[model samples]
Target: MKMMAMALRRITLSPWQTALTALTIPSTTTTTTTTRPHSTLMSPPVVSLDLPDVWPPNSSHFHFPPPINYSNGHRAAVIDGKLIAEEIRSRIGSEVRRMKESIGKVPGLSVVVVGQRRDSEIYVRNKIKACEQVGIMSTITQLPDDCTEEHVIDAVSSFNVDPSIHGILVQLPLPQHLDEGKILDAVSLEKDVDGFHPLNMGNLAMRGREPLFIPCTPKGCIELLIRSGVEIMGKKAVVIGRSNIVGLPTSLLLQRHHATVSVIHAFTKNPEHLTREADIVITAAGVPNLVRGNWLKPGAVVIDVGTNPVEDPSCEHGYHIVGDVYYEEAVRVVSAITPVPGGVGPMTVAMLLLNTLDSAKRAYEFS
Candidate 1:
């Protein structure tokens, strides 16, 4: 490694740098930061701080630019996702009320689950309950483990044509006998609130094409970053894991927001080197404590999406949920982070509700 000495300012990303490359910024008052280059649209931008551009809490969005200083000064600010999600659900409830008054109906979501996996069952139950809490009508079609593919198709087909059903969700990890892709494809594109449809994903990846719905988890990751006042544009971001469900889409989302994104997966060499350079890090690798404190750029905004259950004899449940990041270590090193259970989890559910609300509005041609 070449040894050099230079002044390093705050490791925060710059919005203007990431927002649009073709447009030029007037040479004026701005804070500048510099970092190593990457193979992407931008060399690490020198961030220009414009504090007024930060969104006030009451504005259309939530933003609190960092370096965020808490009383203690060293530990990362834990993102309160449960609180943010509650705010989103409240907004959705108000919209549902308005739609009911104007159109005589509100949004509805249908969940199709096959077999009786305990984990899936709990997820479905929570989803249905969240729907109720947000004033969205929900239906669950429980099929047996031995159910035929035809039965699954029929259930999806029924929802596809139903006038009041605004969104269709197929609970994941279907029984071994079922054809997952075939079933996912059967859901109508218009009602695919889960956003797993091939067309939707394609729209997400392409410029000038807006997706009807973004996958909930990826969408949630972006939302957390935005809400927490973490800039995406012109920053270097690293995503661990390349699964379609979270990591791939999340990388795409970060790139779309103008961040240079690197995806570190099983095949990636010297993953820690790349990760340590990122201004933002999102890991969904599902390996407990896979990311340690040293694998992060100081002041980097981290959104941990992994929710791996590890054995915990002290706990009554015999296990506990932990994220890919080692929270204790990360807290002392990073600027901000989301806790395992309360972080991305609640946001995922909230986005599902919002997607359903959007689907209903689209269905009725309601603004």
Candidate 2:
């Protein structure tokens, strides 16, 4: 019987035969007994039932195991941008303290705001608060909403040559009359911590030449992606939106990291098809829910840059900030997705402080 069982095990069984054996065998049985044509005595089964399937079998029967859930899995290391920024700021503050002790001068950051847009004001105030907390000298130059482009440019030019000021940032979304391009170009590249200068952009585009400062918001986005361990090298990255502020620089940065990048603008035909094929998607279109759930590939990493405020009467503020990608829809599909308000926004402010600190270090040559 054991010999018969061994012979039966040696012969490859069909799926149906295996199912019949399993169905006929009792779960509590320690061994199987069978009779062969030449032998009547029963013997122990020679093959162990615990053995797994051997290779070179039917190709149609093969299937890959399901992927492990990493989006909500236990992270090996938390990418706390806020904590990292705090550590960087503390280091900067200590260095500033040392510089003051040695050279009798400290780094100063000047913020220029041309309008009273509530959001802009809050951003500027937050920047100033960050500077104060870091012990970096901060100054705010506020101009009326009616201020001409000439007035804004003159203020920037003055800060450009000021020996005491190490960094300068001009709040964005200036009054409609102001030529934002010209104003940004007016700030000296050395002090342009906001990194909107044409020279900085040119250097950023060039190979082997690093920009004096990368734009804060885009820098933050890249930092988040990298620290989260998302693979960038040799992956397809799609950036939606081409604004010089975020999309263009971000695409360049991703290219620097060796990603195959494609930039899709408002006019791009079949944007959803392109996004669906990407391993990574970065949306800065400022259009609410422009990147739908179906546009994302499974396991793709999503970075949402838009912070559009839509009316929400249930909230105390009567509005809620949303990203270009629909959060509810994206989280269900993508491997990882960043929240709108708490995602890239805080990191942007943090990177601004980092740039300011870099400007200070460069100005004073503080080791």
Candidate 3:
């Protein structure tokens, strides 16, 4: 197999080799002297060809481990999303306190949850708890699972007009009976803190135009990479999955940072090949273990956005959340890999609060 691989590599370069050899020729030297007084003779430029005695000769070999060290010694610093999130919330709390003292108004975030999705409920609860921690008023408008589309739209419209509600988020994956798109559209651009509104998405897509809010998960991923001092500019980045909420927007954001981005979707052939060639890989495919160790380049930074719950007989909950990456394999190959439950998930909630605080600051002219 190794011999075949080496043969293929050589065959692929033969055409270029012939072209290069055709352009090379022996050179002869000549001496010339200027007519001006006291001018010295000069030799013609010598173009020497210094070819190695053997092509493809071995000089030195070096091994570079993954950029991130996940050993127990450094595991404590792998990144505590929960702790960092709390720090951000505390900062927001102080800002909120100051805003209330000087402007007499604190930021408020209203969440409209329709139907009963257990996971959605948990997410919403966490968001509310985060709001309370940051001193931001939290309100939840819960509607019945059987509620009509009009009812949901009306709730969103009401929140849109309420000056007290600076940010609004409608829990996703609404009932099958409702139109998710229309309901999300009803949210006013200014208060669409989830940043799903077409207007907001458009603003984010346009060059030189910043959206009032960017989607929490993608923003969090970027923040994680940036905070880690990852080099993004001019690097080859591959984003697996093309969903508007994560993959596509994430690629666009990376592009904004001047990274050459290749978006891979289900139809792409040999997706791993592309990923292995990338310097950075962002996977939001929601499939556990979708990416493996051998598919990564050494020192590559991996951001796993999937939060899939897999049955785990050993776990107390009978299941556990895992990211799209095969963490064990990835940690060995990648320089840094975000864990499933403690990575992007917590960051998402943190960024939501950030967007809320930003909205508040803008609404009250406190910037």
Candidate 4:
């Protein structure tokens, strides 16, 4: 099996180097350069944000200028995932219509839910709704938690052979009684638009090969960066976590785009220091607000894939969804950032639609 290129060099910092990189950006600009006191290891780095117009005056700002928008008001540009996802879906809808008119076939997506988990149900419902809005046929098959592995596989097998179904997804977090891997392995790869099949993963990891589908969330993260005009080629990028679904695949995709990549997981020491060296950061670690402003390189672009719920007394639900990066702090520091609830969630669904549409076109050889 091909491996993702290990190109991200580990960084060691001196006292001055640490001070220069970790300093907090000032809310305003200044005419003269200034130096800042070094912060202790226990505290975040503090540097003078006020740099003189003259070059090499006070401190080095990550070898790059502070974000253009940050100087205006310490306000980072908000990447609106909702609008981008909506436009993608609209374009998919138009393509679906064209395919249907010319080839007499529309895309179809089938979601197989194994149990009554509320979260799984909600996800399936949203997916089905998205398919509907895009004019793709949606099918849902809900089995009981006690259902045997064979039973679930049987459902998948039926969808695999059915002429009407073009894409098949087995809702994740299968009950404890079932073998998730065996069942997932049974799904025909051609219909595996989720891109979870081992072959697809292998293709994604190989330099010259291509996966039939890129996993939705990671694809969405890259889409947001590309659409927002963040350069990826020859840039430094860090992806937090190493899960097969998000982190591992995301790192591979970044490498495919020619960005030098690093993946920091629970085992990584001083993750903040490594992250601060990156020009582009895509964080999928589930821990809520795990990334702070001080962890970022000034003018870095952040794409947060975490959606953790934290208690909130002010909201009606008493819970709010937040990404791994601290929004309040990161926005002021990074050049561009994505919001938790709206950032990657919508794009995942949009990519699913595109994948299903692609499946239909492949089936009919219309594309």
For each candidate in the order shown, give its overall lDDT on alpha carbons: 0.83, 0.78, 0.78, 0.82
Tens-digit lDDT track for model 4 on 1-367? 1333333234567764455445654323331123234432333333243221121222223232233244456878999999999999999999999998998889888999987864465568779889889899998998988999989999999999998899999987789888877888998888988888889889999999989988887888899999999999999999988777788889999999999999987545677789999999999877787787878988999999887777788976677778889898898888899998888888988988998889888889997
Which of the numbered candidates is closest to the native, going by highest lDDT? 1
TM-score winner between candidates 2 and 3: 3
Candidate 4 weakest ten by summed lDDT: 50-59
Clashing pairs in 3: 67-335, 68-335
lDDT per residue (tens digit) for residues 237-296 in model 3: 999887767887898789888999999865455677788899989998767677766678
RMSD of each: 14.8, 22.8, 16.9, 15.5
**Model 1 misplacement above 4 A:** 1-73, 313-317
Candidate 4 all-Cα RMSD: 15.5
Q: Candidate 1 on 72-178: residue-level lDDT in tens?
A: 65888999988999999999999999999998998999999888864575568778999998789999999988999999999999999999899999998788788
What lDDT score goes with residue 39 in model 4? 36
Q: Which segments of model 2 are wrong by more than 4 Å?
A: 1-84, 313-317
Please write out the lDDT profile of model 2 over residues 284-323, one tens digit for every residue.
Answer: 9877777767787877889888888788899776777888
Winner on TM-score (3 vs 4): 4
**How far in Å is the alpha carbon of 5 misplaced in model 2?**
83
Residue 353, candidate 3: how far off, in angstroms?
0.5
